[model samples]
Target: MAEGRRVKRYADLIKRVVSEVIEFKLNDPNKGMVTLTRVKVSPDLRIATIYYTVLGDEKQRAKTKEVLNRSRSFIRSEIKPFITSRWLPELRFFYDETMDYAERIDSLLKSIKNDADSEEE
Candidate 1:
C-alpha cells in the first residue's frame, strides 16, 4: 500500500508538471489539442511515461508526438521541482489510444443496436 502510494504521488506530480510545461511553454504549432491522460512511473522512480491524446487525425497526432518528443529535454529541464532524491526520472511520451478505442466500441454498439431494431421492424 505504501509502495503504491509513493508511486502514485510521484506520478501525479509528474503529470501535473508536464502538463503545465506543455500548456505554457510548448509553442509548437503542430501540437494539436493535446490532452494529458495519464502518467506511469517506475517503482524505482527512474523513469516515467506520459500518456496523451491529440484531438486530430493520425497525421496530426504523429506530428504532435514528434514535437513533444523533440521537446522532452526542455520539459525535463523545466520540471526541476526537487521532487526526487536521485533524479527527476526520464520522461517518455506516448500517444494514448484508449480514447479512440472506446469511441470505436461505442460506435460499434450503436450500430449493432440499430441493426437489431431494424430487424425487429
Candidate 2:
C-alpha cells in the first residue's frame, strides 16, 4: 500500500531525530554502528515502528537491540521536543533484515549467472 503524506512526514521526522539527535545522545557501548533505515507510523499516529540496522556480527546486532530497548524512554524524551503533535507516538525498535536479504539475493543471482555462463561455454 502507498504511504500517505502523513506517514511520509512522520518517517522523515523520525529519520532526522534518529540520525541527527538520538545516535549521538545514546551512551550505550553496546549500540554499535546503528543506522535508522526507516520508520512506519500508525495511521492514527499513536505508535511508530523504527527499523534499524547495525554494522556488525550477530552478537553485536543482539547487543545493539538490547541497548536500544533499554534506551527507548530516553529516545522518546529527546524526540518529544522536535515533534509538534499533541501526542507523541510510542516508539518500537525492530531490526531491518531487508539489507541482509538483499545481500543474499544478490550473491545468489551472481552465482546463478556464473553457472549459466559456464554452461554456455
Candidate 3:
C-alpha cells in the first residue's frame, strides 16, 4: 500500500539525516566511533527508532549511547528543516546487536569446520 511505502521512505530519510547529523554535526567529546546501522519508523509516523553500533568495548558503547541520548533534542532540531511532516517523530536510540550476532555465528561456523577437519584426520 501507499502508506507502507511512505513509512519506508520516511524511515530511509530519517536514517540518512540522522547519520549525517551524528557524523558531521554532533559535537561531543565522549562519543566514540558511532555507526548508524538502521532506522525504523512507526507506521503512524510518531516514533523513529535509530539503531547504531560503536566500534569499541562495552564502555565505549555505553558512552556513545549516553551521548546519543543526551543529544537527541539537538539531533531532532538539526533534522527539522529536512522533515516535511507536520509533527516531528520522537527519536529513540538502541544499540544494534546484529553485528555481534553475525560475528558469533561466523566463529561458530569456523569452529565447526575445524572440528570436522580434526575428526577427518
Candidate 1: count of backbone clashes, pairs at least 3 residues apart or interchain: 0
**What tens-digit string does per-residue lDDT give for candidate 2 at 52-110?**
99999999999998998888888888888888877888989999999999999999999
Q: Model 3 residue 25 lDDT?
A: 92
Question: Per-residue lDDT of 13-105 in model 3, one digit per residue for the tens?
Answer: 999999999989998978888888889998889899999999899999989989999999999999999999988999999999999999999
The Cα local distance difference test for each model comes to 0.91, 0.87, 0.94
Residue pairs in steric clash, candidate 1?
none
State the number of backbone clashes in model 2.
0
Q: Estimate each model's TM-score.
A: 0.95, 0.90, 0.96
Angstrom error of the Cα, residue 93, model 1: value is 0.8
lDDT of candidate 1 over 1-121, digit per residue (tens): 9999999999999999899889999988998898899999999998999999988898999899899999999899889874664877888999998989999999999999999999999
TM-score leader: 3
Positional deviation of residue 14's Cα in model 1 after best superposition, in angstroms: 0.3
Please give the RMSD to the true structure for each candidate, in Å: 1.0, 2.3, 0.9
Candidate structures ordered by lDDT, highest first:
3, 1, 2
Number of the top-ranking candidate, with lDDT as the measure: 3
Once all C-alphas are superposed, what RMSD does model 3 give against the true structure?
0.9
